[model samples]
Target: MTVIVGASAAGLACAEALRRKGYTGPLTLVGAESHLPYDRPPLSKQVLSGDWEPARARLRSAEALSALDATLVLGDPAVHLDVPERAVHTASGRILKADNIVLATGLRPLTLAGQPTLRTVDDALTLRKRLLGCTNAVVVGDGVLGAEIAATARRMGVAVTLAGPQSAPMALQLGPRVASELASLHAAQGVSLRLGAAVTEVSEDGVLLETGEVLPADVVVVAFGSAPATDWLQDSGLTLGNGIVCDSRLRAAEGIYACGDVARWHHETLGRMVRLENRTNATEQGIAVAANILGADEAFLPVPYFWTDQFSAKIHVHGFVSPDATVVEGSASEGRFVVRYHRDGAVTGVLGWNMPKQARQHRAEISLRCPAGVAASTPGAA
Candidate 1:
């Protein structure tokens, strides 16, 4: 028997992969939320913007999940883990014991009081309802989620103010040049930029900044970042820090493994332990963990990739971005281009602004270069 915790993208992927790889053992998937596993990327864009229904974001239909032949335990949050017995204790007083266990609990959003944070489909729907009634919104954090929320709100005809410590949105992930261009795009799209300041507090009126300025808004969104959901494993005898510490195989202990946003495993190529809290990594890492569980004994090394759509811009990135970048193809001035980032005379990243195809074609170069800095994606709210 195998028990998978999370029922998220990663957990669903792992369960499907296990079955695809010919595992016929009894399987169970547990989720904290009552809703079925859904794709999170759309929560901030399509779902929130009313372009896509919440049900459309579901990863699989009821019939498809039924075909997998796995028992699903929903709305029962795991409270504790007994490592020795390989058992999971849930909030609903159900104790599931399994021979193999996969931890895919994902993340917990960092939020401020009286603010909405997008993580689940329900959260997206709730925020969407508020957005409809709001005339002004202030989004805290300049990361991927924050930028996305601000863009969505602005498109809905609500005035948006984006506040963060970075000089430009996604500066930490996209580096300086591309991020600055992104700033220009946001400003042109009618989303006010309040960069280079930390959000000191959140009130009924608006968000207070460290610079003693208050950005007034009717709706506030906190999308700064997230931490791994490993609180249930603290006393479970598993090594926990940034996430569940795992080896190259993602094994937390004997008969147990961790994957997705909650797992921080050693990267063979980078020669360092890393944790990525992004949608792509969650699915890919889950598949990789499934392979390792079946005795593939392979090291999981992947070129991180992520895409963001705001207004007329669709940015696709492969690998890590550095400030020093050279336009390899297209033209940045025309808002359509592919740029290669360099660090210490080697290529570290590739980005495409409205040219996804060209950017993907250059993805091969990342493997050839294979610098110490693997293009780990910037963590999202999920």
Candidate 2:
């Protein structure tokens, strides 16, 4: 059997791709969650805001999952992988023997010392339940997820405050200027902003900031990014870094491969080991890794893409851009603009703040330029 670990986007996509690649062997997918594969993006938006139920986050229906032709081991995670024995041991003590293994365990949220955190469906629903008749909410990160949660909480009639140690919200991802505009939009939507201060501790009432300000909140959420869910592979003899260390082909070890947020593979185009935590990379890497699993040997070098939607704003990003080197290309005050980030002399990244058409145009151009310090080898669309 070809055993696939994880049941989210990466796992399910990999399973489907394996079928597409004509793998007719016994297939088994082990998932940590009890529920079937579901879309995670809505957890912070519609689901958290009570606009949609937890069931509405389903990525594929029961009928669709039944068509995948794979045995599913749900709600039980693989705790151990005996590399030499070629077997997996799950939490329920079920042993699975496999000829090949695909590691797509994805990421675990890096939350603060205290308060509730959001990553899975249960986390979102718990926060939603807590938000019922809640007057104040505090989100303990200024990144995309934190900002989204704060926005959702604010829209749900809860006064929200986003606290983090950045100059502006989502600065690391969208750069300071564009992130500043996004921060402004959040502020205009009645969400309080607490930038440039780290949360020291979480209390029953609120969080204590580094600068000694205590913001009282009825609902506190910690969204301090995430790390790889790779603890299960520590004893498996596979290399582990920020994520499961993989080659350019997404191969971690002999007969073992990885993809999605959990796979930190060396990106040939970027000339670095990049672990992207976005839907684009997860799905793209799944497709690419499936081909590699079928002996394609194609290098996974992608012009990274991610999108974020927050209160009347939609941001689309393409390519690699440092937060400190970003500059606005058009009128950011007008709300619909593109933020162009340069690497050396060439444009290496583009961010579209409601400028989707123009941003799509620059992707082909941006992919051609090598990253700031890397030497150019393959040209555009490689």
Candidate 3:
């Protein structure tokens, strides 16, 4: 029997990939949420913006999932893992034993007490309802999720104030130059940026900053970041650090594999352990893990890719962004361009600002010049 934990994108992808790869063994998928598997990236954009209904985010139709011939254990969270016996103890007193166990338990969003954070469908729906009725909202984070939420709420006719410690949104990920462009984009959309200051608390009236300033808002959304959902596996006898530590094949231990946002596996090209928390990584890693479980013996190496849509901007990024970036195609003033990021005079990343085609073309440059897994903080050569 093959049991996959965490029935979201990664877990579901693993199950599907297993069947596609001709795994006819007994399969089971377990999920903490009662709802069927759904895509999470839409929660901050399409779903929150009312562009997509909640059901529209479902990854697979009911008929499609049923055809997989897998048992789905829903609404029961895994509480413990018996590594020796390969047993998963669930909250509902069900001990699921399987020969091969895949851990896709994903990550849990970090939020201030009583503040809203987008991670699941319910969270998005609740925030959407509040956004519709609220006059002003303060998003407390400068990362991808916060920026997306702020943009969605602003389009919904609610005044939004984005608060964070960085000078510009996504500074850490997009670097200073690209983040400056993003700041301009958000400001142009009439979203206030209360950045470069740490948020201390979310009070009844507003958000309290460490700079002794309070940004008043009717609702507060925390999107700073998240940690792996590995609390349930504390005593599972698996090596855990930033996430569930795995080998290059994403194997946590014998007969056990980890994937999605919860797997911190070694990248041979980067020569380091890395954990990616993005939608693309989730699906790709799931497929890779499935193949490895079937004795593919292939290293899980991939150039990370992620996209963000805020207002009129459609940004696509391949690999990591550094503070050192040069516009390679079109001009930044034109609002459509491809920028290449360099660290120590070598290309490490590429960014597309409304120029997805050009950005994709430049992606070839990364593959030819940089080593595999250059996206994970590893330096690339020109």
Candidate 4:
């Protein structure tokens, strides 16, 4: 028997991959949420903008999932993991025994008290309703999630005020130059920028800044960040840091594995362990974990990649970058640029804004670990 926990993208992908890999074992998928596995990326963009209905976010149709021959135990959160007995106890006091277990429990949105944070379907629906009725919105935290919300709000004809602790939007992720360009882009769209500011309080009407200024807002959206949903695994005796620590094979402990946002797996390419909360990572890691469980001697060493759509711009990133890394090419002014992070004359990461083809090509080249010195030769090589 194979039991999978958390029926989100990672878990569902794992189950489907197992079937595709010809695993004919008894499969049981447990999910805390009642809804089926859905694509979350669209929730912040299309669903929030009313361009895509919430029901359309389902990654697998109910019939499709049923065809996979997996029993889905929805709306029941796992309460305990009995490692010695190789069984999981749910909130309803149901004990499920399995030969192998995969923990695909994803992350939960980090929220500030008195502020709205988007993560689940309900949260997105509530936010969409508020945004549709509001004329002005104040967005705190200028990360990808925050930027998406602000962009969608502006498109809905709502005045937007984007605030962040960095000097500009996405400064922590994209660096100062790109962040400045993003700020300019938002400004050109009539979105107000409150850079280098911290929110002291979140009120019903607006946000109170540390500078003793209050900004009136019809809606306040908080997209500060997310943390892995590993609180239930505290007694499972698995290594836990920022997330569940797994080895290069995505194995947490004996006969137990983890993937997706909850798994902090080691990346042989970067010589470090990373916990990426992106759909690509989740899907790839899910397949990798499934292979390892089925007795395949494969090491999951994938080049990290992620993408976000904000207004009219589509930003894609590949590889892990560091603060000290240099951007070898491309500029943010043209909106279509590739920023390369180089370490010792080798490309370590690539950030592409509004360059999908280049981003995809870069990701493919990077995943193959192409010749160490050949990254600089690619088109849009940054």
Candidate 5:
């Protein structure tokens, strides 16, 4: 018997993979939320923009999940994990014993002391309602989520003001040069960019900056970041540092595995541990964990990749680029370039803004261990 702790991308994919790999064991999935497993990446985009309803985001219908022969215990949180007995205790006082367990609890958005965040479907719906009625929105944090919200607000004809400590938008991920260009793009779209600023307080009507300036707003959104949803596993004896620590196989403990944004798995290629909060990593890692759990001798080695759609631009990232890495290809001004991060003549990572085909090729070539020279091509020309 196998018990999955989450019903999101990682948990759902893990269950499907187990069935596909011929695991005829009794499978049970436990989810805290009432809604079925749904695609979260679009919650901040399409769902927030009213283009798609929450029901349409589900990856599997109730009937489809039933066809997989997996019992779903929804609307109840997994409150306890008895590692010695191999059982999970739920909020509803149900003790589910399993031969193996997969923890795919995913993550919760980091909310400010009082401000709201856009993480779950309910959060998006609330935000959408507020955004539709509000005239000005004050967004805290300049990361991907913050930027996306700001972009969407501007598209809806709402005035947006982005406040963050980063020198430019997404600076922590895309480096200063590319982040500067993104900041300029946002500014050109009529969104106010308050870089290098911190929010001292979030009020009912506005955000008070550290500089003692109160920015009037109808809604305040906090998009700072997220931490792993591993608080419930603190006493589970799992090797948890920033998240539930897992090996390359995504196994955190004996008969128990973790993946998605909640697992800090070791990357063999990078020779270090990385916890990626992206859909690609989540699905691939989930499948890999399932294969290994089913006694397949497959090793999970995936190139870290992510994509973001902001306004009219779609940015793709392959590999992790350091700040000091040479800007191998592409210019920041054009907003369509490939930035490669290298160390000692070997390609380590790549970031492609507004370049999908190049990013896809980069991910494929790097996964196959392509030569450095060949992988370092200009955007769109690859």
Candidate 6:
């Protein structure tokens, strides 16, 4: 029997992948929420804007889930995991035993001074209802989630204020020059920019900045990142750093594997451990974990890909980048352009602002130049 905890995107994907790989083992999935696995990207956009219903965010259909032939234990969280005994204790006092275990508990939104967050479907529904009577909203932390929420609320005719410590939203991920363009895009869409503004206090009225300025807000949503949902495994006796640390094959222990946002596995190409909080990584890692569990030597090495939609623009990024990178392609000012991130004469990452074709063309360069000095040797690939 293969027991998978947390029946979200990662858990569901892992189960399906196992079946696809001809693993006719007993499969079981345990989830805290009663609902099946669903897509989360639309929660901040379509669902919040009332353009799509909550059911539309589902990752798979009821028929598809039934075909997976996995027994689902819903509305109960796994509280304890015993590696040696190979058992999972649930919140409902149920003990599930398995030959192998897959941890897919994903992550919980990091609280920002007690502010509300958007992670689950219920949270999105509640937030959408709150925005109905809200005229203005103050969103703390200008990360990817914050940007999406602010843009969505702005489009919904609510006055939105985006405040963060960074000089520009997504600056850390997209680099300064590209992030500045995104900031300008948000500003043009009637979203108030509070870049570099440190939040001092969050109250009923709004968010108070360190500069003695209070932003009047009817609702406050905190998008300040997230931490791995590994508290349940505190004494489970597995390494945890930023997330459940895994090997290059995405294995947590001898008979245990992990995937999705919860597992920060070693990336052999990048030579570091990385936990990606995106849809692409979750799906890919889940599939890889299934293969690895069945005695496959899949490395789980992938060129990272992520995309975000705000206003009328779509931003796509591929691979890793450093702080000081030379742009080798088009400029950020152009509506459609490709920007290459270089470190030590090697192309480390690629950014596409509505330029998917050009961005994909440099995919090989990312893998070939992952090492420090490989760029000089592979002149044609670079």
- Between prediction 1 and prediction 3, the one with superior TM-score is 1
My TM-score estimates for the predictions, one after another, are 0.97, 0.94, 0.96, 0.91, 0.92, 0.94
In the range 57-137, model 2's lDDT, one tens digit per residue, is 998899988988899999999999988777889999999988888889988887665578888999998889898767788
Which pairs clash in model 1? Answer: 319-375, 320-375
Name the best candidate (by TM-score). 1
lDDT of 4 by residue, 1-382 (tens): 9999989899988999999999999999999999988988998888888898889999988889889999999999998998877899999999999989999988877788767888888788999999888878999988878888888889888899998787887765665656677888899998998878788898775789899888898889999777888899899888888888888899988889998888887767645666777788789888998999999957787766777787667877777443444444455656687776655555666777887777666654343343232122111111
lDDT of 6 by residue, 91-191 (tens): 98999999989999988997877677999988899999988888889989888899999999999899999999999988877878778889999999999
lDDT by candidate, in order shown: 0.88, 0.82, 0.88, 0.80, 0.80, 0.83
Q: Assess candidate 3 and give its TM-score to the true structure.
A: 0.96
Shift of residue 317 alpha carbon in model 2, Å: 0.6
Worst 10 residues of 5 by lDDT: 373-382
Q: If both were scored by TM-score, which would come out higher, candidate 1 or candidate 5?
A: 1
lDDT of 5 by residue, 1-382 (tens): 9999988999999999999989998999999999888999898888998889889999988789889999999999998898888899999999999999999998877787767898889999999999999888999988888998999888888899999988998876666766787888899999998879788888775898888888999889999888888888888878877788888788887899887878887766655666777888778878988998988756577766777888767887776554545554566666677766665555667777777777666654343243222112111101
**Candidate number with the higher lDDT (5 or 6):** 6
Instruction: State model 4's lDDT.
Output: 0.80
Give residue 16's lDDT in candidate 6 (0 to 100). 93
Q: Clashes per prediction?
A: 2, 0, 0, 1, 0, 0
lDDT of 1: 0.88
| Native-to-model Cα distance after best TM-score fit, residue 1 in candidate 5, in Å | 0.6
Compose the digit string of candidate 3's lDDT tens values, residues 151-257: 99999999999999999998776778888999999999999999999999888869999999999999999998888999999999999988999999999999999
